[model samples]
Target: MLYHGPMAVYNELIGQGSLKEDDFQRTIIETLQDLHDRLMKYNPEPIVRDGKVAPEKERGFFSKLSKVFNKKEEERLAKEAEVARRAAIPKGLYLYGSVGTGKTMLMDLFYSSLERTDKKRVHFHNFMLQLHGRLHKLKTTTHQHEDPIPFLADSLAMESRILCLDEFQVTDIADAMLLRRLLEELVVVRGVVLVTTSNRHPTELYKNGIQRESFLPGIGVLEENCIVKCLDGGIDYRREKKTFFHSAKPKDRSKLASSSTMPTIVQDSSTILPDTLVDEKRFFWPLGPDTKKEIEMYFKSIRNGFQVTERRMNFLGRELVLPHTAGPIAMCSFDELCAKSLSAADYLTLAESFKVLILTGIPKLKPTTLHRNETRRLITLIDALYESQVKLICSADGPISEIFGGGSGAHSIDEDPSTMGQLTPAQRQMMDDLGLNDVSQVKKSPIFSGEEEKFAVQRAESRLIEMQGPGWGM
Candidate 1:
C-alpha cells in the first residue's frame, strides 16, 4: 500500500465530501505535514536534567579508555554532546484558537498519518487526571523532599515521545504550579515533542487563576520551547449536520461513536438552536409548564410501567439515590443532577446504570461566575452520557445553546455607567445619533465574561446537538 500523509488524507476527506474546504484549515494542515515529516526522521536521546549529570552511554574501546584515563575531559565531551542533542530536538506545535476551528480534527489527521507507535494522544483532562493519580501514588511512597516530577516525566516520555493533547487548559492553582515544572522536565530535559491545542494562547492560560504570577515562568518555558500558532477566524465546523450523527440507529451501535467528536460549531446562522433542532428525537427542550409532564409521558410510553422504583447506587464509598426508576430507564430533574454538587464520576455511574435517562427543569443559565459550576456539571453529564452511549431525554429552559446565557446576553449598555466607560466617546455619539442607544446599540456578550466559563458553555452546546440521535443508547 502507498503511504499517504495528512495532506493527502485531508484532501481525500474533502473530496469524499466528509469535509469542506477552508483556507485556514489548509494552512494549518500544511504546517502539521512538515512536523510529521520531521517526526519520521527523529530519534530519541537520553534525558539530561540541568545541573544533574546524564547517564553514560556505551562507548567503543578508545572512548572507554579515554573515560578512564581522562575523566574530566570525558565529562566535558558528554556535556557538549548533550547540548547538541537538545538543539537538534524537533520543536513541536502549540496550536491555539477558539472552539470549533478544526484544531482537534487537524491533530487527528496528523496522528493518523504517523507511522510510529511511540506517540500517545489523549485529552487534556484525562492526561491531568492520570498525572495527578501518579503524583498521589508517588507522594504516598516517597518522602516530602523527593520531587515526583522526574519519575513521572520519564515514565510518560518513555511511552510517548510525541504527546498530542486536545483542549489544553488550566483551571486551578495546583495544576498551574505543577504544569510548569512538568513541561520543563518532559520537553526541555527529556526532549519530548508536545503537539497540543487550546482555546487560549500561552499568555492567556489560567488568566483568572489565584496567585497566577507564579505560573508565568511556566508560560515562558512553554513559549521558548514550542512553535506556538493561532488557528482562529475560522468557522466552527461542528454545527454542520453530518449524516453520521443525524441518521444513526440505536441498534446500529457500530455506526456510532461512544462520545461526540464535537470540537467546533459552525452554521450559516449563529443561533444555538437552529430549525434542525426543533422537536429533535433524542433531545427536546423549551421548558414550559407542561414540559415535565410531556417528558414523563414519553418515558412511560417507552414501556408500560413495569414496577417503577428508585434505588441508590454505590459509588466511591458513597451512595447516590436516583428517583423515578425502572429496570433500564431512569428519571431525574436537572436540579437533582446538575444543580446539586454531583461530579463527572457520579454522572458516569448514572449513565452506566441506565440505557435511557429523562431529565427535567433545565434553566437558562446566565454566563456568570454563579452559573459556572452548574454549567460545568451539565457539560460533565453530557460527556458521560455521550461516552457511555446512553440516551438522554430532557426538557430545558430553551434550546441547548440558549441553556447558557439565554442565546444572547444582549442588553442596553447605555444605561449602565460601567458599560458606558467601555465605549469610546465617538462610538457613544454615533449610537446616540442613530437613536440606537435606547435599543441594543452596544451588543456586549450576555455570556460568560471569563474565558473558562465561555469555553465550557460552547462545549456543552456542541455536544448536546449531537446527542439527539437514535443511536444515543448502546
Candidate 2:
C-alpha cells in the first residue's frame, strides 16, 4: 500500500486497486521490493550495494521508491541525466515534494540503505537553524569573514555527499539570500546531492509577489542542473490502513448558534440568570453558551451555503458589528474557516483573545512526531489563555488529549529537576495555584507544574532587556 498524507486518499487508492494491501508497513515493504527490482536492471552493477547485488535479493522496495521519485516526463529525463553525471562525479541530490507526501521518508530509507561510507542525511531545518546560530557567533568577536556563505557552504559541502532537506520552503528573505548563495557554492561548485520536500509546487515557490528575484535563480539552476519531480500520486501515502485517521472530525450541534443584525434579547429557558441583550452594533456576542451555539449553527449555515472569505473566522451573523479581534468567535462560514491561512503571530494574537479555539483539519508533519510538537504548542497556547482565566471547550473524535497521545512525541510527565528548571515563575505559580504542581495536576490543568517558575523568570529577564530594545540581545 502506498500512503500519502490523507487517510481518504489512502482509502481511495485502495478502492482504485492501486494498492494491494491495507497495512502501511506491509505496503512499504512491498513497494521497496518493487523499486529494487527495477533499479538493478538499470545499474547492472550494484549502484546501491557497493557494486555488488545483494546475495539474498532482499525486498527493499519501499527504500528505493523513496530514493527515486517520479517527475513529469521532461524533468524525469533531466533527473536521469543528472543521476548519470553524479555516478561519474558524485554530487548532492535534492528531493522535494508537497507536505506529507513522503519526501522525508524516502530520503531516510535511502540514507539508511547506503553504506556508511556512501551517504548521510540531515534535516535542513535543523541544519539551517544551527548554521544561523553559528553565523551569529561568527559575526561577533574576532571572526569577521568577507564571504560567510562561501565559508559556511564549504563546511557543509565537505561533510556529506547526500543531503536530504525536509520542509525546504523559505518565506524569510534573509534565509532566501543566504540559502541561494550557500546552495550554489555547496551543491553546484562542490557537488552535493540535495534532496528536499516542500508544501509548494515548484513554479509557485516565491511566486510573483516576492521582492528578491535574484535569489530565486536557484529554481532555474535546479531546472538546468538537476532533476525536479512531483509525486503526483492520487493516493495519500502517509495514512496507514491499520489506523483510523482523519484530517478532522465533524463539529457538534450543541455548539451551534444563531444571531440577527438588530438588537436581540436572548433568554435561557431553564435558568433566569438575566435576559442577555446582545448589542446589535457589536458583531460579536458576549461570551455565553447561547453565543457558542449561535456560532456553531452559523457555521452549519455557511457550510451549507458554500461561502468563503479571506478572514479566518467570518462574521456571518451580522454586519456593522465590531470585527472581533478576540474572544469566543464562532463560525457559521465553513469555506472561510477551511480556506483560512493562519500565521504564528495571528495564532498568538487570537489565542490571547479567546478562551476556546476550534480548528478542524489535522496538519500533516514529516517524521510524524512534529505533529505532536505542534499539538503541544497548541496546548501551550491554550494554557496561555487559561492563565488569563479562560475556559477551553472543544470536541473531537476522541478526547483532544488522547487523539495522538501515545506517539513518541506525546507529553509525558517529567520528574527530573532539569524539567523543573525549564519552567517560568508565572507558569509555576499558575500551576501551583491551580493545584497542577503534580502529575495529576497536569491532567487537570493545562499549565505545567513547578517547572514553569524558572521559565517565567527567564522570560521576565528577557522582557526587561527587550524593553531597552535593539541592544538587548547584544
Model 2 lowest lDDT segment of ten? 249-258
> lDDT for model 1, on a 0 to 1 scale?
0.68
In model 1, the clashing pairs are: 100-264, 236-266, 238-264, 409-446
Shift of residue 257 alpha carbon in model 2, Å: 44
lDDT, residue 183, model 2: 69
Q: In candidate 2, residue 416 scores what lDDT? A: 46
Question: How many angstroms is residue 285 displaced in model 2 relative to the true structure, after the best TM-score fit?
Answer: 24
TM-score of every model? 0.73, 0.38
Q: Which candidate's TM-score is highest?
A: 1
Q: Distance from true position, residue 242, model 1, in Å? A: 6.0
Task: Report every candidate's CA lDDT.
Answer: 0.68, 0.39
Please name the candidate that would achieve the greatest lDDT relative to the true structure: 1
Off by over 4 Å in 1: 46-72, 142-145, 242-280, 297-312, 324-331, 348-357, 369-372, 383-392, 407-449, 466-474
